[model samples]
Target: MALFRWGHSWDAFHDLEREVDRLLQSVNLSLSFQGLRFGRQYPPVNLYELPTEYLITAELPGVKSEELELTIANGVLSMTGRHISPEGAAEERFRRQERPRGVWQRSISLPDRVKSDNLSAEFVNGILKIHLPKADEVKPRQIPVAFGT
Candidate 1:
């Protein structure tokens, strides 16, 4: 009876493993599950709206300025960059790798209209900061009400 019980437990374990494999396949992230993905669209970002301008920041470590590009049009901002892998270590095996490499692009819509030509970008300590000035018509204005005499 003990041997039969062991066989049943093994079947249950195999069933669970097959279910997990099916789930991973359904999501189409089997490479992510196996840790073999070379480039992933990642690198978190932050966006903030100031009184007169919008501030955008992105974390892009180990990326060069020449490899990055930025574009703004029709209230939409786009950023593209390449995260190059390290040199001479391509043959080395990795036990655990999480950093994303290769080209990545991200586009975000601005909350308000912005003056695309009047913008500035700065990269400091692996952080890219962008300042986009709001359009004149989009800036808030105070309206005064006058009582009829």
Candidate 2:
């Protein structure tokens, strides 16, 4: 009777393991499909905001600066560009491919009101830097406060 019980328990444990493996496989498939669809769209970016101004830096290696487009409209800053992988490379086998290719657009919100006309962008060393000057009225100022007796 003890041997019979042990055999039944082992079978139940194996069944549970199989179910877990199926669930994990389904999740991985879903993620792969989503990544494929996203890669066809825009690439990812990193945005940084400071006290006096907003700074935006995007990674665009292997792409010319002229190929990028930066635009500011209605307080939104947009960076769009395309990074094409090198052709004729025989090593196509990829262990992991998280970096996105193709065309990508990234939009960032300013920390404070900014003068769109005064904005400037520079691309150097595979990094796109954008400097947004804050509006005069929105800049931080020290105000004197009178002590009440």
Candidate 3:
């Protein structure tokens, strides 16, 4: 009944890990980050499909129209932007930085080909809207059946 006991080394290791996490969280640092890709999907977006087009909307606070990049190729739409800290404010002065403060990029695939020439986008009040018009071949067409004359 007592031949084997719980491992003390494993428990000690976990305790040390918890302490390290606490210290890191207090300072708000990325202990495993290797650049700006901090494992979070920034600028969360929503996709909607309509009868004539597809719409994509995203909330991009602190990002201006000139600061964002949008591109579509090979049935995929990509968005990139950066959020900068306030002017004259140092990083050390930030008590908490939950929002990303660097460049972030995200991409999504389209269901079908879209009319690139007819595409439109608008940015107003920190909101981004992109309209992807459906291509001619992809649009649903109504066919009338011939009736007896």
Candidate 4:
């Protein structure tokens, strides 16, 4: 008379699947997953070593020049900035927000000492370029040898 009989094992498997789905939804892969949440690598940068200077370029989309701060100390170059949310963004709920927001910082260690006072920075088209002139002692120089003194 009975067509089929489902066992308790089927119910257990369904429960396990539901739990896995819930766990996945609760985790924000971009921020945290393991024991701790990792900091984001905002405004990824590239460093170029030249004969006389060092060039550092960073992509800072959605961030303004006024919101940025640059400093160098102890052979380290520090960059601090804030990315403000768009106007009226608070009114809507974001299902998935990935862009960096709020105050963030990044630092890069210089291979050699740089003239901080003479350094310059420029921001254009959402890209930041920094020019750090190498110190006198760090710059490679050629020595001339005299055949007869």
Candidate 4 Cα misplacement greater than 4 A, ranges: 1-40, 91-96, 143-149
Top-lDDT candidate index: 4
1 or 4, which is superior by lDDT?
A: 4
Supply candidate 3's per-residue lDDT for 43: 68
Backbone clash tally (model 1)? 0
In candidate 1, list every pair of residues with a backbone clash: none
Candidate 1 lDDT score at position 51: 84
Name the weakest run of 10 consecutive residues (lDDT summed) in model 1.
Answer: 1-10
Which residue runs of candidate 1 sit more than 4 Å off their true CA positions? Answer: 1-41, 93-96, 142-149
Per-residue lDDT of candidate 4, residues 64-145 (tens digit)? 7789999999989899999888877673677666666788888999888999888999888988999999899876679998
**How much is 110 displaced in model 4, in angstroms?**
0.7
In candidate 4, which residue pairs get closer than 3 Å at backbone N, Cα or C atoms, i.e. clash? none
Query: Candidate 3, TM-score vs. the true structure?
Result: 0.66
lDDT of 3 by residue, 1-149 (tens): 12112256567666665565556556665532422223336666778899999998887866888888888888998988888778998879989766557888899888889987787889878889999999999877799999999
lDDT per residue for candidate 1 within 1-149, as digits (tens), equals: 01111244478676665566556556666356232332333556678888889999888877778999999888788899887767765635666666776788888888888899998999899899999988898887788999999
Query: Which is the better candidate, 3 or 4, if ranked by lDDT?
Result: 4
